[model samples]
Target chain A: MTEPKTAIAIQGLEKVYPGGFRALQPIDLEIYQGEIFALLGPNGAGKTTLINAVCGIVNLSAGQITVNGFDHCTQYRQARSCIGLVPQELTTDAFETVWNTVSFSRGLFGKSANPALIESILKRLSLWDKKDNQIRMLSGGMKRRVMIAKALSHEPQVLFLDEPTAGVDVELRKSMWDQVHELRETGVTIILTTHYIEEAEEMADRVGVIHKGKLLLVEEKNKLMKQLGKKEMVFELQHPLETVPPELCGKNISLAAGGSQLVFTYDTLQEDNGVTDVLDCLKAHHILYRDISTRQSSLEEIFVDLVRAS
Target chain B: MNFQGIKAIYRFEMSRTFRTLGQSIASPVLSTVLYFVVFGSAIGSRINDINGVSYGAFIVPGLIMMTVLSQSVANASFGIYFPRFAGTIYELLSAPLSFVEVLMGYVGAAATKSFVIGIIILFTAGFFVPLEVKHPIWMVAFLALTCVTFSLLGFIIGIWADGFEKLQLIPLLVITPLAFLGGSFYSIDMLPELWRKISLANPVVYLISGFRWSFYEHSDVHLSVSIAMIALFLTVGFAIIAWIFKTGYRLKN
Candidate 1:
């Protein structure tokens, strides 16, 4: 299969609303085929705006987007035909049956009716039994699943899930992630925007962090953690200290648990890590510890720092 | 170009019409029949004829025009409006649907709905008044034209409006009143000279008059002018819709 490697490319993309609101700054991003790319951003960080721009739902102020090597503006139909967007809003035809709604979405992409394909999708989403049920009658989770089914009905190579699990229950979220992984295995490139740091940690091959209308960084999951991660060493002090000693005050050290523990934070990427020097300094300062434990920073910590710093 | 896409949207809208039969079909039909009963029997008995034609028969074309105009606009405006309201418009926008295809599906289904109601109202009016068409072909032509034209107007209204009240604004404050004054109940010819002069300015006048001409070959305006007005409305409506699509107004951003 000589399929293109770049599933979607955004170059110098910018969006400025008429009211002088700059929703997105000029940015460049590329999502490859068959990769789970997670976009992490807090509210109003342009995560949805970026996704919408590529989906052609939001008009771009500048730059160009190409999906499957088709220009999103000049070659709109082809570019759009390659994308399936599961919008943040849980919107569906309230009166329509699940089967007809999904089938209709497929047809909108110019695909001929294929009941077998539609049936398989419904079955896969665990919605086969409720296929005849009106959308209004389905539970919230089922409705979201139907949205996913409708998006996939067209069989687009790239799927954009904007906050797919926003209001879903934990179990539903887990099942949804499982379904996403299954879809990824079948060669669908999934790009999801989420506030759940654990989701990115668990699901993304590559993670992009955006803040205040700018994409701060895009990196492999492990690489991001390694590059920016830190480890904290906590020493259970033999005696509670009312204050830090003068000599140990300059380093990445702090007293925690109301002075019951002395915490030393160090960069994981640094070679020395300074754990030995810290212990020696602590020993020399008559700072005795009962025990010591080290823990690496989670993705959530890194994400918070990245956004907070910017 | 995307025939399947158009069909899917069209079928979905048509199915919604069926599902809400009372609101979509029955309400308009029943309302128009009520109009025929009150105006045709009550008003017609008081005023025997308007220019030689029986009042009951004379008001038929106008009544049909009234029902068709409002129904077409109401059907189409709400057809597109509901999708926007429910936010499912994102599905259509993000899909591979061209603006034309989306418009075709929505406008086509809406026109068909109103056309069906128009025919039903025509038949319902027939029971109230003994009707005859001097030019049956022109009658059908005007019926289809008015359905499509007003439906386009409704489509425009759907895009232009943001609130539920705005959707009903033009249909009620503008369209209904225009229809009443546009010679739906009495001809502009029957109005005082000053009022008649002002009445010609109402766009609905041409629509109802042209439609009436096809009934008894009698109209306030010349048949050619009536045809011209229909063509003008169709052209302008098409242009505005094309502009909306091109600019992606209300659909994209």
Candidate 2:
């Protein structure tokens, strides 16, 4: 068997289109077995290109990719068989039933027909009711579920969900989150790319930020938020203020909540982020607060700052 | 080899054909009946015998060959093309399959489809024409080869095509007209000396002539020459398909 820990190892991976467009720069990274790694990026950020390169959908210009110890190029069969990809586009055979298409995916991966496995997958995705229905007749959310079922049909070691919930509704997206959690329970290494930072924050154990064909940073999701996160202090006031106090007018302090609260934004990493000054000023102004709460910057804010700074 | 993969693709393609049985099977059979009515009944009544074979019997092999060739190209071309157009080709590309295995799945299904249609036409022709096969083995051989070879040709066309219109271009502008003028209805020998020599340049003439010979044991061209031409087309088709896979033409990039 291959390395027991590393699910995927990509070294010096690059993709240059025939038209001379450089889609991926030379990069090296490794994903550990059973970890959910979210590659976060905006549109045209080479996230899909990198995923496609490793999945054998796009031939790599240069690099080595090994999935479960099989080289993606030299041992493509073993490597690809171990990897399942749910592309962003909802492309499926309109005429085929859900069961047939999902079973067909298993066969495509070189697995023998296993009706039981297909049944289990369909049932898991809540698609058992629609298994016999044609793809064209299904709702968009159900089709997405079918795509996931197809990816899981072959019992792959690694699953790549490319923008899995790109246009999905909130309820379905929440259900999909549960599905991802369940897949994690089954010990499948999941790597997904998305511009939706909330998805990364909610689903990822680790997050890799890719921008302009380059991997900028990869860190534990919580650690990443803590490292770059800013602090926002909101004080619920007992009295209303028409505007910012003259003493706090030039500071990062503002009136909010219909003048019933005072908000302060500051850098958490700074030795002194003016929080004391703002508090002192509020006290001097005889501002009595009913409650005070601090909120850390979300992954979305950190991601925006990272992309903007880069 | 990914035997399961090939079987899956093959089964999927065949299922499509069965699902549209009217267009895939019944349509070809109906077209064959129409050809028999128009050419065999109407034209045969006015024309004299060629090489002592009745006009109705003379066109059977040609008709079958025509149907086989067209159906093979059409079936194979559409089978591959639809997956590409629909963007499901990504699954095929990402699958654990060699291009050869993929070719086998698609081309095998296409050839089988054309073969079935050809047999149906042959069986349907018997209802209208007094058919006789002097060499049943060669007839089967010719029919099988025509199906396989033309399907390979169609597979190539499917890959080379970027749009639906291009898929029909070669079959319509090239194959259909060539088959019509390839002595499917009349022998090339009945033409003027210069026209007969020029007709020799048309490859379909050899295909139709050789097919007709399997029934009546008479042909405008030698059977050996016809076999050689088919072998050449198969080699060319296989070579082109190999090159396509190697270069990743319209398939990968």
Candidate 3:
């Protein structure tokens, strides 16, 4: 099949500060049009650097980045006009009214004045009530919404949200998620870097994990889980036991909590021979369990494991 | 530079400066009044007429220029510095504004501030001593030229400065002292030959001489020479600022 058109194309992007600090190595990635791509990484993982370099906030030491077929360095105005960036920091003109800030941001992207569009954006972001209020007077979450409103005011085809909901409340986060969904519905390609793994799990169309300035893996969320998912079963004994019986020793089962509980870890993708053999071994050993529970690896666990392994 | 972008940024910056009315406008007006009261009255008594004009009137142009210079520089420097310190420059850098748009927005706002303060100081000086405008058009032209030149200088300063202290260092340590020693209060001709030669090295002397010539139609320096020097300073100042913006000096990593 032919490759899908890319909204953002990054190839061999690198950033090295003047003092010789290498923030990002050469990275090649393509973000498909109209998809929500979540970039997952730990702190100091060069996520912000990559985002800034792509957005032209930082000069790249070496790279070729194109947004919507416009080269970031050569056709910067066109490239930047086609993209909207919501920065990680809560930085706004303190004295500017929310309405003016958003409206002005739209105009900054060379958009003509459209009060109706600006109002709709403000209303969508729930900033209509605070339209006349100075940004300095808004709460942190409200300020973040203002940032989103500003980014959306220009109506760019691609949006880069750098940790958009880092310190936001749960309700607001959900609403923002809904907003992202709505934006995606409207065919806006969204790329976001998030510290909240659950958010990535819930909202991302695809997940790209970066570690130590390297792209570790990029895969579909469900596919990644299905391929790498592991399951663990725990049995709660009716009574505390002193040790695991010798008959159960050959099986991959271990005693826990002074032999009160038995634990078994197995691959979920295995077709057979997991719980049956463990149960058979338990029955042969005359082990009893009041209850049993199975747990599959969550995205959080997968993320932690990936980071640790890297 | 995008005209629309420049307008947007200029409007945004001007709104910020005007939002704090007491700080941006009233305080500068009040401060200029105080300078006229203290300097115009006390120093005017000690000295006689300068170039056939009252000592009070002689220093009026300089005092106004002083306010213009200091306020213009401070406005531009702090305007850019505060955004950098607050980390909001990222928003601007990421926006579609070209470097020229950014410079025009900042320098235009700074020049507006200086022009407003210059007018306020002129009005304040009017209350202390009677003054005459020999050439009103020349006076206005020089006033605008001075404000724009200093505002551009301030733009360069803002880009070069790392912090608030560094921002103030140039205006306080360098620009203020030079303006003071540039014949703001008296003619450089009154100084001895060596001191006069040294004062000639101060660039501000040309700015003040050009402005003073517009008012009294006579100055210690020739009008053509002062105009030429002001133009030269403006060209050099803008060249440096343009280069800084183009290269993103001290702004981008």
Candidate 4:
């Protein structure tokens, strides 16, 4: 297929900190327009550092970044104006009212004041009632929502959320996720960094994994699952046995639950899974089963496995 | 030249100052009044007129300089330092504002605050001492220039200092002592010959002398020297600030 329109393109990006710490190796990735891309990585995997570099909080040691069509350094103003960043830290001006802070954020991007647009954003984020309240007076979750509102105030074409759901309650997380979906519907490209594999699995059209300051892989979410996913068949025996039968000992199977259950693991990509042969072996051995079930490996397991290999 | 961005930052900083009226405006005014009561009454009686101006009037320029210098530095330093301390600086860093625009917003607000305070102290001094302005225009110029220069100094200190104690370091240990010795409370002319020579080294002397000349046309140094010194300091402050932004010193990691 022809290449999709790119929203953000990072080429040969690398960051070497002052103390000789290599925070990121060379990374090249392109996020397509109007897509929800999840950057999944564990703690200290340079996920935040990468985002900070893109946002201009950290100076890049090497490489180039382009947001939409503007160069991040040479065309800094236009590049910055096109992007919004909801930082990992909940840093707000304590004495400022929610309304003023959010409005000020919009002006920071050289945008004219649009009160009606701001009002709608507040109402959408459930912050309309607290608009007059000082930011410090709001709860942690509300403060997070204020950060989101501030990020959106500028009407950026691309948004970066660095661990948006971190330290958030499950209910608030759900609401934030719904809000993100609504924003995406407006054709805003979103790239979020999260350690919650379930979050990536639930929301991302594509997933990128980073570990040890290196991007290990980037692929479409469904294709990744289908390529790496494994299946397991579990058999509940009609009677318990002291040990596995001699004939089935060499197969990729294990007897567990005091030999009352048998589990057979197989790669989903392989055609000859040996299910029929295994069943014939079971019949010849006079083994009977009460029930059978199959399960596919989850994204979390795939994430853990990826990290471990690196 | 993002005027809107500069305005947003300026308004935000000014509003913060207004929010803490007791600490920012009231306390400084109250302290200046107490200084007038103690020094004007107690010391004014013992000392005769210097350079044909009354002791109380002569010290008016000095006292205003003392208050304006320290306060300008303190206000500007705190204004920028608190944002860094709170981690809210990241928002500004990520915004589309150029470094110069950001500097203008912060330094402009700080200079304005100090100028207003200096004017209030001048009015308050009038209640106790008879004051005259020989060159009213020059008086206003000196007051404004000094405020802007010291405010810039404070901005540099704010970025250089990484902690609370360090933030107060130069203002307390360096600038305040320099102001005291630079003839805020006593004229360098009153000092012994050797001390007079030593006092000339203090940068605050030029500021106070130039400012005092505006009020009485009497100064320890020539009018041009004071004016040149002020310009030189202002240039240095701007140069340092420009370098900081260019190198991303203490701003970007």
Candidate 5:
């Protein structure tokens, strides 16, 4: 398949803090335009550090980052102007009205004040009603929406949300996911970092797994699930068996419930998948089965296995 | 470059000042008025005159300088420091502005505040005693210079400070004390011998002396030296701020 246009290009980025903690280790990745790329990692897995480095908040120890073809270091204003970041912390100015705070963010990027655009952004985030309210007066979810409004105020090409739904309730998280999908429809390349595996499964087009400052893998979400996701087929046997039938003994097969059932694990990516072969072997051994069932492992299971192995 | 970015910070700081008018404007203006009422009248009744100017008039320029210096430091420092303390500086750090533009915005707002306050004190002093400015141009020059210079100093202090106490520490312990001893209330000529030389070493002395000279045509130091000292201090302040941004000291890793 032809590669999509690159929105953000990170080349050999490395960050070793002053105290010698390597926050990121030579992470080289490219995020395509209009795709929801989720950097999924556990706590202390350098997700925040990586986002901070790209946003130019945390200075990178080494490497180059180009945002929309502009070198981040050499042309910072042009590069940073194309990106917006909603930090993990809710760090709004408490006394500022929602309208002013969002306007301030737009002004920070050298953009002329466009009240109508800011109003539209707030309205889209369902925060237009609270435009005159002080940030301190809003609830946690409103403040988060205000953050998103501020990030979108400047009309950036790429939006980086560091754990956007971290502390949100289930209902709010779903709404936020819907908002993210809407943003993607508007042609904003959204890169979010989250430890919520289900969030990645729900929202991301591509997923990257980072652990111990190292980026282990980056792949299309559906492709990753298909490649690593294993399927288990269980056979309900009518009679107990001492062990797996000799015909299927050495295969990716096993017995369960004290031989009352036979379990065979297979990869979906494989053309044969051993489904037909397992049934033939069971019949050849005279192991009668009342019924059969198969189940596919989820992305969560694949993610856990990848992290554990690394 | 990035004029809008500079204006954003400048306008934000200015708005904060207006929002906290009680602490930022009213408090300083009230204290300066109290100083004029107490020192101008009480001392004017006794000393009568200093270097051919009435005691009340002689202290006018001094009072304005003192208030401007301290307010400049306090305002600029709090303007930047509070954002850092509140964790909102990430927005600034991640903005498209260069460090110079940011400085222009913050220091510009701070200096404007102190300048306005200094003018208020100067006008209030006129009501207490008859005043005449020997050179109004130089008077305005000194007032503006003092405001800008001290605001720059405060911006540096804000970046260097990590905690709230440290922010208040410099203005309270260092700036306030320096203004008190820097000949704001008395001329260095009044000090006998040893103390006179000691007072000369205070950098704030040059600021007050130059400003006083503009009003009464009398100063302890030569005009050239005072102008040179102010210039030197301004250059140093810019150099330090540039270094802070270059090294990303206490701002970024």
Candidate 6:
């Protein structure tokens, strides 16, 4: 079998500040080429720290990180040349025009002047019309697009977006995702961190869950969903009762609101999810239900559960 | 250092400085004119000559140097401080530009601004006193050197300062007082021997002496010593800035 090519390789990454705070703890990860990798984590989970370390913004306390075989520290310029980072905050020289900002960012990366490329990037981001306007005059969403334009100016092979849509509107969020998807198609490996689980579900080929500076799990998106997803069944009683009967106790069924409703939670991956047994017992006890409904756990539910567990 | 990066950054910083033209250019020009009015008219009649030049012309170099130093410091410090305040330093840090590129871009823009303002002040002074340049070449050279030195010093201050108030603290408290005490409006020779020696301890005194010597061809301090002090200041200033960049002080953390 051929060896899998890696775009980014990190081993035993650790970042400990001088004040005894361990921001990152021995993280090991490998990102494949041209893959959309989503790092899902809550606040203070060291997502930014990891990204900063890879981009050479933050010095590493201990670890090895290489970008396309270039060491992040030793070959910082080469490694940085291959990666474009759009930080979480909207940061740009406010007095500069949108066009100037993008072009200047390209120059900062040692790229020659390419007005044609910059123009196309602006048009793609819907910023062509606003190209001559000062960045301070732009709206929040437009400023966010300018950040994207700046990052893309160098034509980097790998792009890291830290919460690209944290405060964006719904339409822009979808459009941003589309742009990300399009970039991936152009052979750019994209790594993004988002609190929005739907973004990961809709966009990520591989999902890595980070909690409290630790990698909780990393797997293919569909595989992770298939492995951890659960189902819930709720029943409305025909007649309201003051209390639950002892029969449903051992089955893990919970009485809701004076026994008027019963709730059952089960793992969806199980062949026999125990819903049938619970219904059988209810029928055997002559309990009548007016209605029944079931719901499958979403990525949001799984994410919440994983974060809560950690 | 990438020249393209430096040019891009220089253009960006220049536009930023120019955007507040009323404050950066007009305010300084107006203040300089006012200095020529208040000090030149009031003191020129009392002190007949300073090193064989009219008192009005004598104070011109000191005033111009004062403006150059303060404006260079203000421009460079604010150039770096505002980006940090607006949280744009992260963008610069993550970019492929090296530290040297960043420093040169900011300091170059700052020196340009101060140099422009210094010329404006000199012209504005021309309207008041009949000024003559004894050595135009040396004058321009010292002007450029002084602007560069102070601009680099301002860059260091910008990197070290965390807040707008802190940025203002050094220029307002330390640099301004030193410039004033360095004898922009008066000659150090008029002071007592002990006081004159104490004033020599001020670095601004050398800058003023060098500038005054270029204009009058005579000065309280030797021209060579002034030039030497400015060179030493440049060396020390560059060293501190390079060290800060290497350590990523205030920039990274």
Q: Write the per-residue lDDT of candidate 5 for residues A84-161, one digit (tens) a residue.
A: 999899989999999999999999899999989998999889999999999999999999999999899999999999
Candidate 1, which segments miss by more than 4 Å at Cα? A1-4
Comparison by lDDT, 2 against 3, better one: 2
Candidate 4 has a TM-score of 0.97
Task: After the best TM-score superposition of candidate 4, give how far the Cα of residue A298 lies from its true spot, in angstroms.
Answer: 1.5
Interface RMSD of each: 1.0, 0.8, 1.3, 0.8, 0.8, 1.5
Q: Which numbered prediction scores highest in lDDT against the true structure?
A: 1
DockQ value for model 3: 0.69
Give TM per candidate.
0.97, 0.93, 0.93, 0.97, 0.94, 0.93
Lowest-sum lDDT 10-residue window in model 2 chain A: A1-10
Candidate 2: where are CA atoms >4 Å away? A1-4, A236-262, A267-274, A284-290
What lDDT is reached at residue A218 by model 2?
87
Q: What share of the true interface contacts does candidate 2 keep?
A: 0.84
**True interface contacts reproduced by each model, as a fraction?**
0.91, 0.84, 0.73, 0.79, 0.85, 0.58
Error of 6 at A55 (Å): 2.3
Q: Please, what are the lDDT tens digits per residue for candidate 1 over residues A69-166?
A: 99998889899999999999899988889999999999999999999999999999999999999999999999999999999999999999999998
Q: What is the lDDT of residue A286 in candidate 2?
A: 94
Query: Who is ahead in lDDT, 5 or 6?
Result: 5
Candidate 6 per-residue lDDT over residues A1-310, each given as its tens digit: 9776799999999888778898888999999889999999999999999899888787788899999999887787788889999999988777789988898889888888999999999999999999999999999999999999999999999999999998999999999999999999999999999999999999999999887778888899888887888777988999876666788777767778677888788887788878789989989999899999988788888889999998
TM-score of 3: 0.93
Computed on C-alphas against the true complex, the DockQ of each candidate is 0.84, 0.81, 0.69, 0.83, 0.78, 0.55
What lDDT tens digits, residue by residue, belong to model 3 across residues A141-242?
Answer: 999999899889899999999999999999999999999999999999999999999899899888898987888888888888777777889999988878
Residue runs of model 6 more than 4 Å from their true location after superposition: A1-3, A233-248, A255-262, A268-294
Model 5: how far is A174 from its true place, Å? 1.4
lDDT (CA) per prediction: 0.92, 0.90, 0.86, 0.91, 0.90, 0.89
What range of 10 consecutive residues in model 3 chain A has the weakest lDDT sum? A243-252
Least accurate 10 contiguous residues by lDDT in model 2 chain B: B244-253
True contacts kept of 6: 0.58
TM-scores of chain B alone in all candidate structures, in the order given: 0.97, 0.98, 0.94, 0.98, 0.98, 0.97
